[model samples]
Target chain A: MATKLLSRYPWATSPFVIGAPMRVMSGPALAVAVSRAGGLGFIGPGLKTTDTGVDLEEASSLIDKARASSFKTLSSSSLLPVGVGFQLWSDDLSTAMGTIEKYKPCAVWLFAPKEGQKDLDEWSRRIRAVSPETQIWIQIGSLGEAKSILQSSEKPDVVVVQGTESGGHGRMADGMGIMTLFPEVADTLASSHIPLLAAGGIADGRGVAAALCLGASGVVMGTRFLASSEARISRGYQNEVVRASDGATNTTRTLLYNHLRGTYGWPPEYSPRTIINKSFIEHRAGTPFEELKKRHDEAAKSGDSGWGPDGRLATYAGASIGLIHNVSDAERIVRDVRNDASRRIQGLAAA
Target chain B: MATKLLSRYPWATSPFVIGAPMRVMSGPALAVAVSRAGGLGFIGPGLKTTDTGVDLEEASSLIDKARASSFKTLSSSSLLPVGVGFQLWSDDLSTAMGTIEKYKPCAVWLFAPKEGQKDLDEWSRRIRAVSPETQIWIQIGSLGEAKSILQSSEKPDVVVVQGTESGGHGRMADGMGIMTLFPEVADTLASSHIPLLAAGGIADGRGVAAALCLGASGVVMGTRFLASSEARISRGYQNEVVRASDGATNTTRTLLYNHLRGTYGWPPEYSPRTIINKSFIEHRAGTPFEELKKRHDEAAKSGDSGWGPDGRLATYAGASIGLIHNVSDAERIVRDVRNDASRRIQGLAAA
Candidate 1:
C-alpha cells in the first residue's frame, strides 16, 4: 500500500534522496528545498507543539512560499510532495492526527512510539482514515522490530532502516549497522513488497549508491542535511560538522548530552549520537549531572559559539560527519549525491 | 607504493574483491579460487606457527596444487598474486620473515603488533628489504591508527580499514562502522596516494559498490567467504553461517568463545565476532567460566553436531550473515559480487 502511494511521486526519474526529519534541524525551508530538488523532504517532529499541535498554519504557508519560489522550472508533477515526521512516543495522537488531516502531507514518518507496534498500528490506521493518500513510513533499528511491523496489520508504505551510526534518538544498546541491518530487513520483507529506505551514517553519493545496491529504494539522510544551508541549525553546529574529521572518535552515542540540554523524556531503549563536546568531555570525566546541566545552561547563552570544541552543548551528528566537508545548499547535496552515484554506477557498469 | 603495486594486478577491469585472511577459514585453496576468479585471495594468519614461522612449505604445495588444477583459463597476470597475513605479536618474526622472503607473495598484511606504529614501520621496512616487489598492507580499525600510519616514516602500500562489523578480530570497544570510517580515512589520506580496502559486513555486490563510492579501491570480505566452499571452515560453522538470519542478535564480540576454544593470547584491543551458540547462551546466562569450558570440551568431542543452537562452540561470522543463503564456491562468490555490483551500478547510473 505504501509502495503504491510512493509510486505516484516523481522519484521514478531520479533515485529517492530524502532530507531526513532531523529534530530541530529539519525545517519547512529545508523540506521545500529538497522536495523542489526532486527528492522527498520531511519537516521534523520538533515542529509539533504539545499544547496546540503541528504548526500546520505555519507549515502550509512555508510550503506555499517554497512552491512559489524559483522552483518554477520543476514540472508540477516533478515537484515532489513534502513529508512530516512525528515522534509517536511523545506526540499527542489526536493533535498529530488533526495536524495531518489539516495539512494533508504526501507522507508521514512515524518513529519512537510510546506503546510499541500496536501504537504504530493505531497511528497508521488513524492517518489512513483521515488522509488515505498520506503514505505511512515507519523507522526501525532492529530486525525484531521489523518483524513485529511486518506482522502488524498497520503495514507501513516505507520502512526506514536506521543503523546505530545515525544521529539523534535510535536503538540505544542493541543496534546494528545499516550495511547488515538494511539487507536483513530487505530480505525479511521481500515478500511483503514494502520499499526500504537506508538511514544512518550516509552522507554522500557513495552512501546513496551503496544503499541502493543494498536494496533500498531510497535513502533518508539526517547528518548530511544538518550541514545544509536551509537546515535550521546554528552556525557552530554546522561548522563543527564540517570540521569534524573522524566520526569514530568524534561521535559517541550517549544520553549525557541530552540530560545536560534538559531534553529528557526519551524512552530507555534509545540514545542520540553526538559530536563529543566539552559537556561530554566533562561528563565522561565524572562531573555530576547537576553541575554539567548548570554549565550547559550558561553555555547556551553564547548562541552559535556554544557548540564548538570548548563549548558545553550537544552537536548531535552521526559518525558520517567525517564525510561532510562543507555547508552547501540542500539542492546541491541532493543533486551532487545523485549525479555522483550515477557516474560511479556508470563507470562500474562500463568496466 | 601500494597503489602502484595493486595497479599491476587485474583489479582495474572489475571491482577489486578480496577474500579476507580470516584466521582459520581462509586457506590456500580458498585464496587460489578467489584469485582465479579475478579477486585477490589471501592465506590467513592461522598458517603462522608460533615457533616454526608460517608453514610456508605446506602453503607452497597447496598453491602449486591449485595452480595445476582447472585454473588454466586464468592468465598468469590475471591470477592475482596470493597475499600472506601474519599476527605480528603472536608469530615468530624472524621465521615469518623467512617465509615471506622465500615465497615472495604479492602482499603481506600485518595486524596486532606489540609495539604499535613503530613496530608496523619496522615490519614494513623488513618486508620491503627482503622483497621489494611485495606490497605492505596494514589493517587499521580507527582514524587514530590511520593517522599514525600516515605520519610514520615507513608507509604501507594499502590501508585495510576494518569496521566494527567485520568478523574475526577487530576493534573491540571503540570502533566505527564502515559507512563513516572508510570515507573519513579516505579523506584523511586523500593526498597520500595510498589505496584503501574496506572490510567488515561486505557480503555482496551492494557492499562492494558502496565501498567503491566511499573511495575504497577494493574490499576485503571475510564472513561472506566463510560460506564459500573452498574456505577451510568446519561444516558446522559453514552451516551456521547459512542458517543465521539476524546477525545483530545472533553474533557478538566476546573473548568467552576464544577462551572456551583455548585460542588465547590475543592483543587486548582486538575481539572476534562470533555467532551465539549454546556456549555463549550459557556464558551470558551467568554460567561460570570453568563450567562452560568443561561443557565446551564435552561438546567438541561430538564433532560437527556440537556447533548448532544447542552446541557449545563458537561460530565466527560478521553481521552480514543474513545475506548469505548458501555455501557456494569462492570463485562464484567473487564473480557474482563483482557482476552484481556492476549491474546495480549500471542500473543506478541509467536511472
Candidate 2:
C-alpha cells in the first residue's frame, strides 16, 4: 500500500486524468492540446443533441490525430498517455472497440455502463482480447461505485472518481461534494491495488497540491479547461466563462436544459452544473421535465439560434468557473500546473 | 466611485459603530457571542504594545465557555447592529479587547494605507463622519500613522486599525505598529473626534461579526474571529489556534508568504494573505529569510527563533488569541458595535 501510494500511477506519468468522450467538446484539436498540457486527453463520439457534432466517423479522424501526436510526444518526453472515452450506456461496444483496436490508444475510458460492473468486466475482457496495449479507465460517483469496479473480475488500470463538483454529467446529491467525498474515496481506495484520479473543482496547481495531500496522485480538471482554445464550445460560451462572476456560478442538477433540448436519459443521481444562461432562463427554469422535452423537440427542429441568458444553449460549466478568467493555450496551463505542483511538493517535504 | 462604495459600507443603524474585540479566537464567549447576545463588545485591541489596553478601567469580564462556534454567517444576519474586530494591526488586540468588551458589538474593521491608494480621502472620511449621530470609527495600521485623519484633518468618532499581523507591533515600516501607535495617540486627541483602535488578522466571529464588523459601529480585525469554530482552516492548525497558534504573531512587508505558500496576489495586488501553516515547507526550500535578515540587522526578526515554516509557533495572530475557535455570542458582538458607535453619533446628532 505504501509503495504504490508513493509511486507514480503505473499507466500514466502523472495522476492528471483527462476527461474522455468529451462529446462535441473533445475534438482532436483539444485532445492534442490537453495531451501536450500534461493531462491525458480523450476523444469522444458526441451523442449530445445540443449541436450537430462528432460521431464514429469524426471519432476515427480524432483517433488518427491523437495517434500521430502520440508518437511525437511518446518519443519526445514522458507522455501523460492519451486515451479515448465512450459512454457505454449509450454506445455500442463494437464500434468503440474498433477505434481502440486500430489506434491502440493509451487508454479507453468507459462511463455510465448499462450492466454497471458487469459491463465494465465484459468490456475489459473484450478490449483486452482485441488490443492488448489499451488500458481501461472507469469513472465512478460513489465509494460504493468504486468498490463494485474494484471487485469486478477484470481490474481497470485507473479509477477516475467524479465528485459532485463535476461540471457536465455527474452525481448531484447534496451529501456528495468534493471537500468530503474526495478524501473518503481516496482513503477507501488506498488499500486497493488500483490508482485513483480525483476529478471536479480542481483549477489551479494549488488545488492539485491540496488533492495530492488528500491521497490522490493527481486530478482531472473539466471546467477549468473548457475555456481553453482547444475546446470546441463556441466563443460566446467560452467568453461567458472568462466573464463569469463568482456569484453567478452557483449550480444544481436539473433536467431543464436536457429536457428542453429533447436529450433525455441522464441517470437519476447525475445532473450537470451550469450557469443560468439565455437558453435555460427562457425555456427551462420552472418547466417540468415533460414540458422541457416538448420545448427541446421544438428547438431541435428550428436550427438552434442565439445565446442569451434565456436562450436554450447549454453552458456546461462547474463550480471552479470562478478561477478560469482567460482563454489560454492548454499546454501553458499544463506546464504551469506540473511545475507548481512539483514546487509545492518539494516545499511540503522540506517543511 | 468613492462615495458609492462608501455609501454601501454603512448599512448600520444610527451613527454608532461598535467594536467586537476578542481574545485568542472570536468564540461566542469573547466577541461575536457578546455582540450578538449582549451590548456592543468592542472586538479587540490586537498587538500587545497598544496602550488602549493598559488604561481601560471599563467593565472587564471574561467569557470562554462556548468554544468553537464562530463563523461568517454572523455578518450577513440582519440582527442587532453587531461588530467584531481589532486595532488595525495589533499583536495584542485580541486579548485586551476580549477582556474589556464583551457583548453585542457594532462595527469591527481595519484598513491600512496601501501602496497605491495612499489617501484616506473618501471612504474613511465618510464612515467616520456619517451625520452627527454616527460613531466615528478609525483604525490605524501604526500608532505613528493616522494618514487618513492626518490627511483630511477629520477624525472618526472611533479610530481603530492597528499593528500588522503581529503579536505586538504596528504596520508602519519601522518599529511603529497599531499597538505602539493606537493607544499613544488615542489619548492625544484634542476633540474626542474618534476613539483609536487596533487590528490586523483577528480570527474569530466574536472578533469578526462581533468586534470588528459591528464594533465602534466598527472595530478592526485581520486575523482574529476569522478562525471561529465554524470557519474552516486546515485541521492541523484549527485544533491549535487558541492554545497553540496564538501569542507570538509577527508581520512584515514582503511577498514572502504568498511566494512561499502558493497563492497569487495579483490584479488586486496587495499585501500577503497569511494563512498560519501554508508556507512551512516552502520556507525551508529557499534561502533562509532568518539568515538574510540577520545580515540586514543584528536581529529585526520575522523569523528569529521558534518561527519556522512548518510549526509556525508565532502566527500572524493579533493580541486576541484567547477568544478564537468558539461560537461566541453574536448578539453581544452586535450590541457593542451598535451601541458604541451610536453613543458617539447620538451625542453629536443631538447637539
Candidate 3:
C-alpha cells in the first residue's frame, strides 16, 4: 500500500499541500474539501475517543459523506483519499487499529508517542498489518527526533517536520525554524527516499513556495486552515487569528490554556502556541494557576466575547497569523495557495 | 543618494543577497567579493573607530585594494559599490561621517542607535548630506521597530528584518521570525514602497529562495558568509560552522559569549547566537561569570585549537550552521546560492 502511494507521489499535478490534522479543528469535512481540491487532508486525533465511542461513530459517518461528495468533484485518477491522525500517547491502540481497519484511510499521522520510536514502530507495524494501504506519517519537532525516526526498525512513509512556530504542541526547549530545519532534515534523509513535508508558520502561497524551495515534497498548514469555514473552530478563535499580527508579540507557548480547558496529561516536553490574552497577562504577573483557571472558566461562558483582550481563552495559532486575514472555504484556501505558489515560482524563474 | 539607489533597485539581475556587515568578520574583501558577484556587500561596523583614527585609515586602504582587484573580474556596469556599516551608539559621528564622505560608499548600515528612530533619522539625514549617493539601510528585529522606522521623519532606502535566529546582536525579548515578520512589515510598509531584506539563519539556496517567498526584496546573511574565504573569521570558528548541525541543539543566544570575549557594552536588548562550548556549558551549569571569563581568556591564547567542545572561546553562528558544510570563496558562495535558488524555484513551478 505504501509502495502504491510512493509511486503516485512524483506525478501529482501540483506540489502536495496537506491540511494538517489539527486536533478538533480538522474534521472529515475539511479533509474532503482539501483532498477534493488536489491536496491531502487528515481527520485529526480528536475524532478518536476512549469512552462513549461517539466521536469515532461521527467520524465514520462524516468520512462516508466526504467520500461521496469528493467523488463527484474530483477526477477518478486523482484519489480523494482522506487521512486520519492519532495522538499515539493517549489513544488506545486496538481502538485506533480497529477504526483504521474499518475506514482504511490513505495515511495515518502519528504524533506525541509516549515511548518515542518504540511506540512509533509498533503503531506503524500495526497500521500496515491492519490496513496495508495506509501509509505511516510521523511528525517530528527536532533533528534528534528525525534521527531517531531514521534509525528505527520501521520507518515512516512520510516525515512531517514541525517547527516551534507551529500552532499546537511542539518542541519546548530546542526547535529549529523551518527555513533551516527542513533542508537539513532533507539533506540528512536524502538516502531514505521518504517524502518530507514542512509544517509550522506557513500560511499562504509564499510559504508553500518557500517550503518547496527548502526541499519539502509538500507543506502541511494548520493555522491557515483554522480560518477556513470548514474548520471546527469557535468564532472568537477565528476572529483572533484574523485580527492578529506579529506572532512574537501576540502568541506564547504555554500549558496554561490546556489545563484551563480540562485537557491535561500531555507530555511535558510540548506546549501549544496561543494568542496572548488577559489570562496570559495575569499568569505572567504571578497569578496562581487555580485563580487563572477560574477566570478562564468564567470567560468561556461568554461565548464569542470570551476570547479577546479582556477574555481568557486560548486562540491557538502560529506566527503566520499575520498573513491570514479572512475566513474562506477550505477549497479556496488550498487552491489559492497552490495557484499563487505556482505563479510565484514561475515568476521567480522568469526574473 | 537614496533616490538614485531606489531607482536602480528594480533592475538588479537577482534578488539582492548581501554579505551582512558582521562586526570584525565582514571586511572590505568580503564586501567587494559579494558586490563583484552581483550582490551588495558591506564592510562591518568594526572598522569604525571611536577615538583612534587608525581603523578608518586601514579600511580605506582595504577598500582601495578591493576596488583594484574587483575591477579585474566585474563589468564596469556591475560596479563594486561596497557598503559600510557603523555602530551608531559607539562610533564618533563626525569621524564616521568624514570617512563616508571621503570613501563615498554606495550604502551605509546603521545599527544600535541609542535613541532609536530619532537617532536613525538624524544619521540618515547626516549620511545623505555628506554623500547624497549613499543609501541608508537600517536593521530591525521586531514589528514595533519596523513601525518606528515607518514613522520616522527620514525613511531609509531599505529595512533589514533581523530575526532572533541571526548570529550577532538582535532583539532579545520580542523578536519575530522572518516568515511572519517579513510579510507583516512588507504589508505595513507597502504604501511607502520601502524594500525589505531578511536576515537570520539563511545559509544556502533554500534559505535565499524561502526569504524571497516571504516577501523579502533581498536577504542579508552574516553567518553563511562567515565560512566564506573572504570573511575575516578564525580557522577554528570556520571549522566549527562546517562541523555543526541540528542548530536547535548546537547554537544558543546569550550574552555570556560577548562578555567572555570582553566585547561587552551592547545594549541590554541584544544577544548573540554562538555554538555551545565550554563557556556556555559552564554558564548553564551556574558557573560564575568571572570564572568563565578567566577560562575564556586563557583559551583565547591557545589560538585555533581553543574553539572546540573543550575550548572556552565563542563560535558565533546562526541556526543555519547545518547547511554550511565547507569554507568556499565568497564569489562561489554567492553565485551558487543564486543559481541553486533559481533552479529550485523553476523546478517547483514545473512540478
DockQ (CA atoms), all models: 0.66, 0.02, 0.70
Superposing all C-alpha atoms, what RMSD in Å does each candidate have to the true structure?
2.8, 20.7, 3.1
Q: Can you tell me the DockQ of model 3?
A: 0.70
lDDT of each: 0.81, 0.48, 0.79
Report the Cα lDDT for residue B157, model 3: 86
Clashes of each: 3, 229, 2
lDDT of 3 by residue, B128-158 (tens): 9988867899998888888887788899988
Q: Give stretches of model 2 more than 4 Å off.
A: A1-20, A48-72, A75-81, A247-250, A282-305, A308-310, A344-351, B1-351
Model 3 residue pairs with clashes: B1-B132, B1-B133
- Tens digits of per-residue lDDT for model 1 on A1-351? 324534666442366889888776788778877877878888888744442234345556665676587654333542236788888777788988888887787789999987779989999999999989888999999898888987998899888999988988899766888878888888888888888889998988888877877778888899999889999888988888888768777888999887776678887878999899888888889998889988899999989889878887889999898889898999899999988877766766665
Q: Which stretches of model 3 miss by more than 4 angstroms? A: A1-13, A47-70, A73-80, B1-13, B47-80
Candidate 1 per-residue lDDT over residues B161-263, each given as its tens digit: 9998888888876678888788878778888888889999899888888787776888889999888889887898788889887888888999998899788
Please tell me the TM-score of chain A for candidate 3.
Answer: 0.92
Evaluated with lDDT, which candidate comes out highest?
Answer: 1
- What TM-score does model 2 achieve against the real structure? 0.50
Residues B26-54 of candidate 2 have per-residue lDDT tens digits of 33233434333432444444334243343
Worst 10 residues of 1 chain A by lDDT: A47-56
